[model samples]
Target: MRLAELQGWIVNILRRGSVLAAGGLMGAALAAPQAAQANLHQRYRHVVRIHERLGGIASPAASGPLAPGIDWIVMDAATGRILSEHNAYNERFPASLTKLMTLDLAFHALSHGRLNANTPLPVSPAAASVQPVKLNLVAGQTVTVMQAMLGMTTLSANDAATALGQYLGGGSIRRVAAEMTARAHALGMERSEFRNPSGLPNPNQVTDAYDMAILARHLLLDYPQYRYLFSVPSFRFEGRTIPNIDGMLKRYNGAIGMKTGYTDLARFNLVTAAVRNGHMLIGVEMHAPSWIVAYNRMTQLLDAGFAAESGAPTTVIATATSPQPRAAMPPPPVRQPAAAPVLVASRSRTAPVHMIVARSVGHVTRDMIPGWTAQVGAYDSYILAKRQALTIRGERKVGIARVGSAVVHRHRIWRAQIAGLDHNDANLVCSAMRRAHQSCFIIPPSNESLAMR
Candidate 1:
């Protein structure tokens, strides 16, 4: 769906936020076939009956005046600084927000080469039996891992999430939940526990806003390559276009998708990440009264964070890089003649040299030179990227290897680059750096480089 249309849809929904039940927006925006919705509700009603028999809410429906437990947090994605928080550590039902951890595990599998986008995962009877707000997969059928991820992200497909969890956990959803909890603890999400990949209600399955922030940050920084799955507006499957449930992607500028979740017990939960002028912030709202309130709270948190960061000089300062082994250093710049451009010499055989060419600082602005850029690395933090760029330039100077940091706004990452090198010089530097066992890549001049400014 287009941005304007999505914004209009959310606006219409928000206008009725007052009367909308906690889970009403979810059902309204499901986009499932009418029969599927009916069947899913019937299944949920049956579950509710079983729950009541075991002593739980008698009805699946939750009227809007949300009960007390509300936890919220906003954190600076780069620095791990807490911008604002309230009741952040209080555990509550996670609902579908639990899928973030599920995705985290899937991302780890993909990164480690154990899984791929085309890998097919089987849908078992247990997975097919998951409740509403799912992809409606048939048991014994296979869905590619990528399709399942999109289904989870866009449709919040319970069946797809369960299938993915089972596949990653060696065909045991119970095992995957344990792995998810262990992974959560490893990531410093100490307050989280996972009982199911679909975030279906389990009395023991719980998480807090603070832990959700940690999980969201991992999704953004740790599994950056697959982050696109979150922002996808929609995906086509079985000849149907399922719009992403994350209205933030379409409604808010610079909003990178995270996740949205709701269940009567969990009320409304949202984790959102947004970037502005190279600054990224993640906000979590758990147990919100309604979807509108959750989104509004997140927007306020991020807007205030960006505003504060803008007014103050960025805390994302550049840190000096630790010296690499002399053997790993690209051979020092060829000795320049006394009259030739002053070459800053290495301070010592083992010490990394840093030459501040005062006269040559602006010799090659990104706009003035039309050539490829040599990138050493892209870092989650500006400080790290700047440090790498500075260190790499000190070690190797092919042409004017002017250190520069370019913000890849789309990913909210900083690229450590030595811009202004022509294609030949770029290739030479990359080759030399590679020979020295250092990372380097030639990035051709493009609009993306313009972001360096």
Candidate 2:
């Protein structure tokens, strides 16, 4: 149905304000699969954006032009067709969206009889040591698989996720993360990788918005029995009822449950699913400048998704990079150049997530550009990254190094970098830093730096 065809909705559209106006283009894409409408070969595929003046003021989009690298995708649960998307394939830091895989792994364990709901996951020192935005499970405390999942989903508890990862990894967090990444690839998440179960700021951990959407679809299709885990209003843990971190469950009509996350580097990330008129749709938004903006915008997109499905019933197609073959459904249309850039008024009042932690370390290589860089910390300010570099050099009292800022997602953050060092020297620096009880990753000049927007 075209704009006039959606007669009843026109009234609602006028009443909804700029949100629906901005999000309307997506609704057109979502209008479901019509043999004549979805033209994959066209220069302009499903892109629809409106940039005209409103309320006698230039829209925020005129000034901002849609913050770079923000990715979003919506898919029909019944049909795998990706109804709408932008920057959907670009790799990004997933933040807490990583927990969906943790949930998948745990659910896999349950289904395979390798672990039962009653299985005990004792908190390791590592799990306890993870920073706050955690459940605060003390070291040696034991929690059941169910308890941990509740914490992982509702509280977005880092400790619980880490504890579960440690348990499932056979005492090796790295091993479990590798296994999760493998499973994700097998399930058709081609551009995704994982470093930690909890989505702490690790540059090695990366996934595109489309990959997350595939994961969401699998969660809905693969484990319908466990759908309650994602949408539950609240769950009890350690004698407290922890409300879900997903705000849409209460605020947005038909909002079910999904995941949410934020880090200065990952920025705010979200994956949401909702149902209306018996149709289900999932929304994935990454690298939003603010939580409020991300949530509101997603709700608007989901409304479009539901409206689209209502216009026509969806047909099954591959969602995201799924390897599954769809002989009947046609390939997705080529992206139409957007008529207007997507933009939002981000209220940056909330402090950015502090992802970097500077600590005691030991290493030295003075007055020489070594060739390779070993990064230990990340900051929102270039000055802070440089200051941390100076402090590290001052502590070592023998090495010359400098700090640089890199773009992680849309957020411009500082990296505590020591550039111009050889591989061996970088290794030795990292080895010494690790021994000094710090974390480090060697960065080569040719390395795919996460700083690039």
Candidate 3:
């Protein structure tokens, strides 16, 4: 072969060898990622098993016939360990026990200046109409927020719950109930649902003992400022003195205030938080055959929890993140622009930009408007899209608007958006949005946008 032909042949062979080597490297890179992912899953599974084993202690059923009616849970308040559980997650009507949530919100309101101890909350007609065990608060009459809290907690007054709900939620008991459900979910009380601000006889108002225990833990951990409200033995209101219904408070040492509930369907429900030996323990018993039985069972659980730490070598579960002192609740929510709407040929072809709705300290109201202004863009889900609205309350603005099932299901996530803005404002708003940790992007309007209509 001539010298030029030989050189050409050598270059071709080198190129082929390089291609083979590159292919092998790419294959190894892809396989390496999968191997790493599998290793991570294995590690996670191992940790999960270790956690489960550490938590797994056989809870012997309570002694004797009384055990059948008793459903209980005992937890280490600080660590959230279930020291013992018996039927903890069984569904039961919450009865007056539902007031704990009401009190929690009331306490939050007082702390944040949404309402104050001395603030006069109006007694709406609905509030006055609540059947109970009531303070007999007359409609159009007003009671101080402190007085209302005392009435509700010490006396389990349904009327007081309604009054607070009306005052804080704009006279709509239903709206307050919805807010309660939302708050409950946020607090991780997944097994609980609320139908009214007051624990009226709604068939739907039910929760598990375990869930109530979680709520009790949050109240103790997050809102220690209002702890005194739970401990009141007697509340004198409207010239009438009503003693606390929780008999355990007077009988048990270190007994803190918690609520009690009873109903035909729910039977008896009690949530008790007590501190012994510098350890706080929360015990919940629900649907007990009798009130006294429930009370005794809860006490027993608390005693056991206190005893669990005694003389036994403590195995610290490092999983619990150190508890941070409760901070103020978030600001009120704000509404924002809807996710990107479909575009038409007649409309401008400007690209939509994500806009942040609002920013504030603490939890925001679910309904506040995001910003005074916004741009627009297509989003995958209402939730994802809402991150761009500059307001803390933008989460609630997300909702599904149907363009077509294919588009909706494929990108069910919400995207952030603002309406008409010049390029400079859009860029500025987007930058601010990014600082707030919102996900956003710009999208050019096109024929595809027309399909949204």
Best candidate, TM-score-wise?
2
- Model 2, range 32-137, lDDT digits (tens) per residue? 4322433442321222111111122222331111236567888766556667776565567798999999999998889889999789999999998885456667
Q: What local distance difference test score does each model get?
A: 0.64, 0.64, 0.57
Worst 10 residues of 3 by lDDT: 43-52
RMSD of each predicted structure: 22.1, 19.1, 27.2
What is candidate 1's lDDT per residue for 1-453, written digit by digit as tens?
479866764564344334233333443343243334334422111111111122321223332213375677777776555666665645577889999999999999999999998999999999988765666688999999988998888667788999999999999989999999998866766558898898986656878777788788767766666766776655567654444657567557888768988775577789898878767888888987665567666777778778766786333221121111112112222121122111112112222212222112222222112235677776787677656666666565433333444445566666667754545767877888899898888766453234243
Off by over 4 Å in 1: 1-69, 312-453
Candidate 2 wrongly placed segments (more than 4 Å): 1-69, 312-453
Q: Candidate 1: lDDT of 319?
A: 16
TM-score for each model: 0.55, 0.57, 0.55
Q: List the residue pairs that clash in candidate 2.
A: 40-333, 44-336, 45-335, 45-336, 369-420, 370-420, 370-421, 371-420, 371-421, 372-421
lDDT of 3 by residue, 20-115 (tens): 334434644455443444354221111111112223222233321113466677766766666666666445678888888887778778777787
